[model samples]
Target: MCGIVAATAQRDVAPLLIAGLKALEYRGYDSAGLAVLQEGEIRRVREKGKVREMESQYLADPFPGGTGIAHTRWATHGVPNKVNAHPHIAGHVALVHNGIIENYASLRSELESRGHAFTSETDTEVMAALIGERLASGKSLLDAVSSVVHELEGAYAIAVISDKEPGRVIGARRGAPLLVGVGIGENFLGSDAQALIQVTNRMIYLEEHDVVEITRDRVRIFGQHGEAVERTIHESELSTDAVERGEYRHYMQKEIFEQPRAVADTLEARIGPHGVLPNIFGVNGDELLGKTKGLHIIACGTSYHAGLVAKYWIEDYARLPVNVEVASEYRYREAVVPDGTLFVAISQSGETADTLAAMRESRRRGYLGTLAICNVPESSVVREADLKLMTRAGPEIGVASTKAFTTQLAALGLLALQLARHRGLDDARYADLTAQLQSLPKKIEKALELEPQIVDLAEHLIHRQHALFLGRGAQYPVAMEGALKLKEISYIHAEAYAAGELKHGPLALVDEDMPVIAVAPNGPLLDKLKSNLQEVRARGGELLVFADGAASMDGNAARGSILRIDGGGDFIAPAVFTVPMQLLAYHVAVLRGTDVDQPRNLAKSVTVE
Candidate 1:
């Protein structure tokens, strides 16, 4: 949830550190600060806003030194205030940290007993304080840091600088990302590749519980015990457009509209003119279920919703039994993954902490080789998986993901069809499905024509306090995600249910003031969903219908208005479905004066658990 960039070099390093922080601005931050060790002491500057705010402060009184650590924090332990910002300092050690320390309270209590007065609410402050306390006992800097390692709890990628060791920056990672940039007589350490992408793409991904000691001329990697380990540097090829948001009000809106193009782009690159699908991986699909057999899908948030959409495609087309599990919870259960088990991991970043951890757990038990469907090519998930597909989504900057999620559905839907063909499905039906897949973009464009009215509908519901989205069968997951989007950015109270389940419980929440949004596509379930809408109408509930062309409305229906979308084919529904829901959330948030790009209490990348 925070950004960290540090450089320990033989030459001046302040300019490079600032550039790296600018590159990581898209990850999100609330405050910015930097610390440098120079002239036998540590100098620091921190501010409560953007990096620019810190920059202005630094210009007045810069922390000039060869070795330094910086942070762009998204406040968790304290409010976004100057005193709460990072680059917390001790007597001789200055440190910056990412991720939370679960046991900081107990640590703080112990430090307080030792006469270490706390100044900030941040768990990071405890790190510096602990190191200071240990150093007061006359321990070496390395020993002081190493001693605190055994006492700290929770995930962190941390960097420390000491006046006594002015030429080096000692760093370590337990869960969050940390990289070492190799340069002649200079070394770089950062939380993300983007932070160091401009300076040098050549770097090594630090492993779990690894301590990295960086100096002006050398970078040493060590195990938690200080045992030496050799690491290789891999080059990064990041495109300029990967970070720029061209000609859009916000990244969320741009990503929402990028869906059709992103889907089309993934198809052009992965699928051949001959209709053969990408690799299905050789792992036994049944093995993932503990020999009971079937595919086990793991993902988090938006990607998990995409997995749910793919659930329909796999079951309907391939006749394969499939189960979708949230990656964060997948490992906790004794899921008996059968032999030949196919584990499908869906992620946009492909670096989602929980999902990546789950994928590693699956590999540990000898499940079938995993398949990764992700947008980023060199991402951790893609690198670890046996087979992978890149969604070619360029870059999705919105905290509430739009393009990446849709493109994932498109790619996974194609994966499902590919598996069906491999399993000896009928050629004619496959051909029809292929045609539908190819025709999805045009239908998505037709759906975009309804956007202006969607903006209007969102404006209508903007002031309403609560909402419900309902769908049946394949569209059930679509309903779930639509509700998620509304609640994510707008801070609205929203929930989703199968249209058929209204009578069970969700119906009780419907009233004149509460609006119900229905995902009624032109299919067998359309009439069933329509009947549910009428049921809501009976209770005086306001209904906003997002429907296919076939969902007819009588002249002047009193309870709701029907917004028609071109539902050309069966497979096209889910691909084109999320467009309206995205715009609805976008417009509603716009009307409510909310920041659509970065919502409250959220970060674009969930790098820390």
Candidate 2:
């Protein structure tokens, strides 16, 4: 994933571009750069690190211009360095791009044969060179970009600025995301709405193969066949404060603490005093979910783990068979989709490339329909799906997701309730489940209270090179999520396994040097999990358990430490248990002097396959 921000404004646009890049920093970038058309010349500034570094350079030596393009790059084609950073330039053309150019090597060869020289190892540079060549052949900037896109193969959202075409920027998207922000006297381009939200609340989400050209006060869009097209302008509901890390050291920390309110926001109006309301998904949600015989849930990374938890919830509560597939694998294989099986895609960004591809492929696999569970209302997955459910987690800026995961669980829990109703679940049990779902925010709040204990536990874990997370039944997914958080942020090598599988192979990795963390909720499997913990104790494995408040830790404290969570019921424990896992990872990452918000080699949204 990368970030792109471009603007054609009446005033100096350098500051706006920098600010937009800062807002999009969470998408994960190793380097930053910007190119501005100043005095009919393209001026460029690039940095090998954070956007703040480029901002500092801009503050010292300003690159003032009325039109500019900026980028924060997550390296794919080259090493992360100033030379390889974005704003790759060729002649008068300067550009920033997101996503891969599948046929860049051949394009590079062709360009070289035409006497074009290259400087950087980035495919973006090849694209810039190709556009420059087209311009040299007397093509307009828009024509250059639009025509070159036809020759390109693979996903990309690109913005180009030329010194010859001052006060204007050309942008195009195919298989990747790009949008336009409409302002009073300015227009903008960004990878997503957040990049331009600070400057404009009005946005136009571009569709596939749409090319747009923006000047100071005009925006023109073209369809795939070069025909003029119009797209609806949506007013963004996001405020600047939603992306700020208020009172918290990092975005991850703030998002972790915001889980309670986030879940409440997701559940707002969708639930009533009696149970989850019908048609919360959409007008036809009841009819589609009612006829569903089976489900195929597809996702990646943290969202994949959330789907795993949902498999447990839907099967246990709704009495339906569910299969959770990693979107990357499912997209490339021929899957056995039974009749009446609904395909559900889960994603925080809703633009995760693999998951979106999998959802598109499902349309040809004889599935009943597609349902999108996502946070972004205008994301591609939501726009394409037949049914939609918004997670309402707001903007999750942290590369390692916190609020998004919990809100997804809450939303999926409601889905389970809806399906259970169709299965003739008793009225009294439905009310009880609804009551527990309503009270989940308080349980999450109680779990957040365990941060101090988790902070203390981080001291013992920061120096450890490896860890093991254990859980049973539904909590197994919770354990997997915990391990993912630890490794993602703290760089600790962590793994998770079902507690009953200790005797298989994971047990051999446990020893005094490895810390074994378990989510021990007081449930049907509590005693069995305790037995598994004893196996760890026998091998002198250091134990750190996140246990229920009522669960006994009689002998556990003798050899280990216990952090208690006031888990009100087993039905909501997954969301509650998620808190300490996030807190521990945050604290450990802080202690290890790692990037808590943007972990190395990881991006917030996996937009590239």
Candidate 3:
């Protein structure tokens, strides 16, 4: 994923462009660059590092202009360097792009044969050169962009500026996310709404194959066939404070702490005086649940782990068989869609490439209905799905995804309750579940109080070369999520298995050198989980246990380290236990001196397959 922002305004746009790029830094941060129209020519500035480095270099030797485009790159094509950064310029045209160009190699060869000299190693530069060549032959900016998009193959959200058209910019999107910001005397384009919310809350999200021409006071949209198109402008509800780190050391930590409010916000509408409300899953929610005989969920990364947890809840409460599949793998293989199957796609940023493709592939296989549970209302998956549930976790700036994951679980919990009600759940059971869901925000608050203990535990694992996370039932997914968080941020080699399955193969590696982390909340499986811990202890494997306050630590007294966490309630323990694991990963990464927010080789969103 890369971040793209363009603005044409009456005042100098460098400051706004730079600020927007900073807001979108979580999407990509390998390199930063911008292109401004100055003195009737394109002035380009780029640097090989974070946006702060590029901003500092620009302030030292500034370029002034009222129209510009900027980018923060995750570096898909070439090594992360100035030559591979965005805001790539070719002749009079400058462009910034997100997503991949599959046909760039062929196009670059064709352009080079036609005597067009290439400078950068990025595919974005090839696209820019193609547009510049078309513009050089007398086509208008919009025409050149429109022509080039048809020739290109792959997902891309691109913004281009040409000196031939002094105050005009053109943007196009195929399969990646792109939005146009509406302002008083200016207009903007960016890959994310958070990047544009500070300047303009009103935004127009471009659909597949839509191209937009933006000027200082006007914006015109066109379809792939060059016909005029109309798109609605929606006002964003995100506040500026949501994107700022505030007093937190990093956005990851701030987001981890913000889970309480974020989960509360997600539950604000689903729960009421009686119980979980009806139609929380959009218009025909009750009817869809009634007709649904089975459920299938597709997602990637943290969202996939969220789906795995939901599989347990849905099958337990609604008495429906559930299947959870990785979105990327699900899209490639032939799917088995049974009769009356409800297909669900889960994604934090609705633009996840594999999830969107999987949703389409599932639709092609003829499911009864499709549902999208996502944070972004205007995302592609949301627009394509028949039913929608918005997580409302405002602007998760951290790449590690703290608030978004918990909020998705909150939404899924509401969905399970609603579906169970349709399956003839009694009012008392409904009320009990509702009460637990309503109490979750405060329970999560209590969980946050265990941060000091988690920090201490993290201190012991920072130097460990490898680790194992063990859980069972619902906690198995929790264990997988913990392992993912550890490896994602700390770069520690970590793996997870069901505690009962530890004796299968992983127990062989369980010695004092490799620490074993267990999820031991008080439940029916607690004794069995303890037995699994005993097995590890027998082998002298160093252990870290996250246990509930009610769970007895006497058995684990002489074995290894034990940290007590508020189990919240029976149904809500997963949400509560999730906090300490997040804190462990966050603190461990901090101690290891690794990039907690922007881990190497990972982007916030997977916009390319």
Query: Which candidate leads the pack in lDDT?
Result: 2
Q: What is candidate 3's lDDT per residue for 312-412, written digit by digit as tens?
A: 88888888889999998998898788999999999999999999988888868989899999999999999999999999888887789888999999999
Candidate with better lDDT, 2 vs 3: 2
For 1-609, candidate 1 gives per-residue lDDT tens digits of: 688899987766777878788777767788898888778888888998889888888888776778888999998788888888989997788899988899999988988897888889989999999888777789877778877887788888899888877798888887677888888788989988778877776878887778888888888888878789987678866655666678988888888777778889878855554564444333443232223235888999989999998988888888778899999899777788777678889988877888888998997776766888898766678878877778888777788988888788878867777777767679888888888888877787787788889987887788887899998887889989999999999999899998999999988988899899888788877667777888898899988887777767543237777888877677768767778888999899989999888788777778666
TM-scores of the models, in the order given: 0.89, 0.99, 0.98
User: How far off is residue 590 in model 1, in Å?
Assistant: 1.4
C-alpha RMSD values across all candidates: 3.3, 1.1, 1.4
**Stretches > 4 Å off in candidate 2:** none
Assess candidate 3 and give its TM-score to the true structure. Answer: 0.98
Residue 255 shift from truth in candidate 1, angstroms: 1.9
**Candidate order by decreasing lDDT:** 2, 3, 1
Alpha-carbon shift of residue 460 in model 2 (angstroms) = 1.2
Q: Which of the predicted structures, 1 or 2, would earn the higher TM-score when compared with the native?
A: 2
Provide the lowest-lDDT 10-residue window in model 1. Answer: 284-293
